[model samples]
Target: MGSEKKSRLPAIVATAVAVPVAVVAGVLVFNAIAPKAEPVHEDLSPVAVEVPALSEEDAVVCLALTATAPESAGGLQARPVEGGAGAAESVMAYGDPAVVATCGVEPVAVEDTALVYKLNGVCWYSDEAGLEWTSLDRQVPVGVSVPETHEQPVDVLNDLSTAIADKVPAAAEAPTGCA
Candidate 1:
């Protein structure tokens, strides 16, 4: 019984050592035989970003832009003229004869004292309007589609630059983090 127990101890010891070694060898063999994962590649190609042209109807000028006037004879104030037609309430008037005369422009009289004038692509009238050259203008209507206002003329150009930036598509792709 003693010899049998001693032989069993050797067998158990051998099994413990061999089992760990076999496991390690099996792991090495598996790593060498198993297929490796493929590397991922990104397909980055240039794409054309097309943005359509914006029209006046697509954008609207703020009421402040159409009404505010810098210092001048014809355009001396930021005053809004409310309620004449549809969406006409945003218009403001700036009238200064002294500034107008200095700008080197003539006035076309609408009334005896009030003259209809065109300046800076805007139409307006000054009661005591005098001939002057200014960066601002008082432009009256040559025909239909014109309204008379007593303030300095202002024409707000509706630009869609901001809208274009938000609406335009990305024509190119940028790299992400170290994927």
Candidate 2:
């Protein structure tokens, strides 16, 4: 009886060790055979981003972007606020092409912004509907022409943003004519 009990103990030990080793080997084999997942990159298109509701007389894009890039608590006064602090302060200040993406608003399309090449650090004058020379610090060529009504919405915005980003570098190359 003692020898039989000892033999059973070894069997139990062997079973326990073999089960764990089999499980581990099976996991390794499965991992080797499974297809790897490709890294996912989010499509950062502005229109792709869900747009917040828009009410007339409200600068939704600017306000949204301001929220994302908030300044220090009291620095709120220093950081530009959209529609409230004014367009020039809000839009002209952002020189990055990523502004539209950050704001989650499609860039506005207008007739006059087409012909005129807007310089970097200048606003498109859209928040105020072109009524007041509301220029904001935005990315775009200093004199890059803003898009007209006929141009595609996404294309125009993308172009304008790209222009804004390009304008700064171009301006740097051109000698200062004013001063």
Candidate 3:
């Protein structure tokens, strides 16, 4: 009886080890044979951007905002800026046509009748042509320029709003039209 029990223990231990080994081997083989999706390669040339001189306070805010900005927005990856000094800290660009954003820019001038939108805890105002969208609720307004090629430009704004909300502080008062 003792001899029989010892024999059975070895079999049970072997089965346990063999099962896991087989599963790992199968997974590795399957992965090796699986089809892989092609990686997307985008032109990462540094984009040229112009920014007004920033106040010390505004520069601090811009630095914080850009540091926390996402690597990708609206399905497009962030790209470098062309300016030699301080531009990369204040500006970010994305996509082929380049959805460009400049931090610490002058706020959008909102007329009494203009439409103001609050999305993802950020308020926004868009230009008549919808090519430009600016944050109306942040301490320093963030301006994002969308190309005409993007059909739904506001969608791109929505993607960026969350980061803007998190990193940038709310304005002392909401924009005139935005409650």
Candidate 4:
């Protein structure tokens, strides 16, 4: 009986050691066969923008307006503007070939016969080619230029009008073509 117990001990010890070794080997083999996870890279290089001189009131208004700008627009993340704090405060950009927004831009002049869109209480005037849209009813006009690659530039205006409505006040008079 003692010999039988001694023989069983070796089998028990071998099982304890082999079980752990097998588990370790299985884990290593699975890791080797599994698909590797690759890190995702996002382009965040600074975008170039030229800042125009603004009136004191326009400057203040633009700073406030830009402060309320969203972190993403038109499915693109916001990129850094090149011209330091002044440009950052007055302008914002998104994606490559960036969609740029400049506060305190020249106000849009909409002819009575021209088309105008009123979105979220903000009036917008689009250029002929639909590349640029300007806020017509804000104290400080905000211009957004969308690249031609974007099929629906008007949607970009619709998205930004919310921020403009929140931060910028209505002009003294409503736009001529916008009801």
Candidate 5:
């Protein structure tokens, strides 16, 4: 009885060890053969914009400008606008509010205190914070909101100027003393 019991103990120990080894080997083989899943990307939702109303003619011009706007700005792809208000305007946003462009904005009143920048044959008026830029030379005003994250806002303006110039007609003249 003792000898039989000793043989059974060795068999049980060997079976226990073999079972675990087999499970580990099976897992490794399955991992090697199974297809790898593609990495998941973060969902970038559209930015919410509040746009002002526009005149009929201005709305048409805005639509044209929006249609011609670039698909991407500063390496960020354009996304749809959400929560917009007003008539016949379009909003183009990129990268969770990194850059935003709105057409059909009311013409900015260029005050003596305003800072004006001229680039790519277009004139832009900036508010005190310089966060917003309104095109002063277009018949129908267009505004671009550039976040502080951008090192150079002028580069973004330059990139969009061609589209604005091509689609939106230029005013007879820009505001006085605006360069």
Candidate 6:
């Protein structure tokens, strides 16, 4: 009886250890095979937008333009804009401090020294301060304010460029150095 009990003790210990090891290995294998979750922005609250005064025609154009704004920019999801009826003029936003868009803005006045970049057929007047970018070729200028935290402003612009091109008309006088 003593010998039988000692033999059973080793079997019990081995079974306990093997079961736990098997479970841990199975979990690791499952994790490796499963699709990874996409990164998500923490804040989804309405972003505050300071809407500018726009002409009746510009306002109408802006409303239509904003309606076509992209659902996502730079892999971030769109959030609602805060403020009053003026906020309706704004395009969607993504992330905290937000990558925001406002349409029907006054044409950007660029000096010869100003930095202008043509991206996806849209001419952008970029102000390094606050990372603001305004469309220089659109009839009713569109503005985008991207937070410094955003790693890829160009990617964000790329996402919105198609929408801007489809909805906003080109200005008669485009900024110099643009395609």
Candidate 2 lDDT, 97-150, residue by residue in tens: 222222223333445324322433334434323221222333221212222332
Candidate numbers, best TM-score first, in rank order: 6, 3, 4, 5, 2, 1
Candidate 5 backbone collisions, by pair: none
Of 2 and 3, the candidate ranking higher by lDDT: 3
TM-scores, in order shown? 0.26, 0.31, 0.74, 0.73, 0.66, 0.75
Better of 1 and 5 by TM-score: 5
- Model 2 alpha-carbon drift over 4 Å, by segment: 45-57, 60-179
Model 6 C-alpha lDDT versus the unseen true structure: 0.82
- In candidate 3, how many Å is residue 110 off? 1.4
Q: Tens digits of per-residue lDDT for model 1 on 107-139? A: 233433333433333333433332221211212
Note the Cα lDDT for every prediction shown: 0.30, 0.35, 0.86, 0.84, 0.77, 0.82
lDDT of prediction 3:
0.86
Q: Give the CA lDDT, 0 to 100, for residue 17 in model 3.
A: 99
Q: How many clashes (backbone N, Cα, C below 3 Å) per candidate?
A: 25, 27, 0, 0, 0, 0
Better of 3 and 5 by TM-score: 3
Q: Identify the runs in model 1 with alpha carbons over 4 angstroms from their true place.
A: 44-179
Model 3 lDDT tens row, 47-96: 99996588988888888888888888888888888776789888989888
User: All candidates: CA RMSD in angstroms?
Assistant: 27.2, 18.0, 5.7, 7.8, 12.0, 8.0
On lDDT, the leading prediction is 3
- Give lDDT tens digits, candidate 6, residues 56-97: 888878888788777887777788887777686655687776
* Cα lDDT of model 5 by residue, 54-162, tens digit: 7778777878877777877656666777765642256767655457888877788876655688777788988767779999988878888988877677777887887
